[model samples]
Target: MNTHLLMIEDDHRLAQMVAEYLGHNGLQVAHQADGTSGLAQLQSPDTGSLPDLVILDLMLPDMDGLEVCRRIRALPGPAAQVPVLMLTAKGDPMDRIIGLELGADDYLPKPFEPRELLARIRAILRRRGDGGTPAAGQSLRFGSLEIDRDARTVTVGGQVADLTSYQFDLLVTLAERAGRVLTRDQIMEAVRGRELEAFDRSIDVHMGRIRAAIEADPKSPKRILTVRGVGYVFAKQQE
Candidate 1:
């Protein structure tokens, strides 16, 4: 199946250009000119199936892109877990930071090449999967915690753990290499990201979120421990 993408962009010309370009490249593109319409589309998929990914604009006609992102993450069911690739027109690094903290999987600054955008879209989708660490249907167990690659889910004691798709893959990267400390660069490389920015602390942000989801106490994470000046390591032994 061609990857499906919903783009919420206000610029008519840009939206048309993108839709046409992506459509020709083996993708299915759905366009919404404003945040309200885009959100409504997500809330009620005309095709009765959620798009695989959302391409959100930072600046929207009715709401801030971040607000739209916040709403998307707040959505219930699988829709809430859909990966988001945010588009920003600003040069401020904080915008990217806030988006990530709010559950955005990736961000691309405006004035970007269509090729780069397509590349990013592909990367985000690929990184959300097992990504070489675990095969489909493989499950990793640590006490009450379970990482199921086939389902792309993480659960602790049978209770579903809420995680963005990117976060799920990040967890898989660490779990598959339990007990070994990985630097930020190594983690990013392993996850096959479009790679995090130089010295970007976004990895820390993702780790904090992941800890909150699976750890009994996120404040004192036992499953994933920080290596003070090094990076992080997934614990091999868990209670």
Candidate 2:
């Protein structure tokens, strides 16, 4: 299958540049100069065709980028799962946060080099692939907590939890293989896109954070167990 991408930006020159650059990089690019048309195209199965990725501009003449993002996320099923990379002139941290909160996988400020944009886009897609959407008829439950892999979401007693990308991936990985021991290296490979360095403490930090969030008692974790001189395991009853 071809790698399909939709670029939505009102700036004709910018859109052309991006489309050309991405195309040169071997992706089938679809361009739209306005938000309304872009939204309509995305919704239109005949024309939109559900691209693998979306490059969106936050400022549109017809609508706010945030609104566009919300509408896209509201899309049912597979359409809603398409990764979005928000390319905009807005540089405020709040704006970036809002973009991610609205379902954007990544945000790149304008004036970015085409190469950098490509790299960012690649990383976002790689992360999504690492998570692997939940399989049909397969749901994991732990107490009141639940993980719907299909939706890439976790709920606690029916209430959705706000988790960072890393956290979500970690939880899903561990829960998917409950009761199995996973070394730090294995866990890092499963979620993080790259290899772990010998001195890297990133996994430890992530584990601590996850324990704090999911464990009823962080001091004595029940769900995530540590194996001395080995690795970690996910289990309600200690093995």
Q: Against the true structure, candidate 1 has what lDDT?
A: 0.87
Task: Give candidates' CA RMSD values in order.
Answer: 2.1, 6.8
Taking all chains together, the TM-score of candidate 1 against the true structure is 0.93
Q: Per-residue CA lDDT of candidate 2, range 99-121, in tens?
A: 76666766777888999888877
Residue 162 lDDT in model 1? 84
lDDT of 1 by residue, 86-205 (tens): 998657778988999899998888889999899888888777651234465679999999988887878899999988878888898899999999998889877754455775787898
Backbone clashes in model 2, listed as residue pairs: 134-149
Worst 10 residues of 2 by lDDT: 125-134
Top candidate by lDDT? 1
Using TM-score as the measure, the top candidate is 1
Instruction: List TM-score per model, in order.
Output: 0.93, 0.63
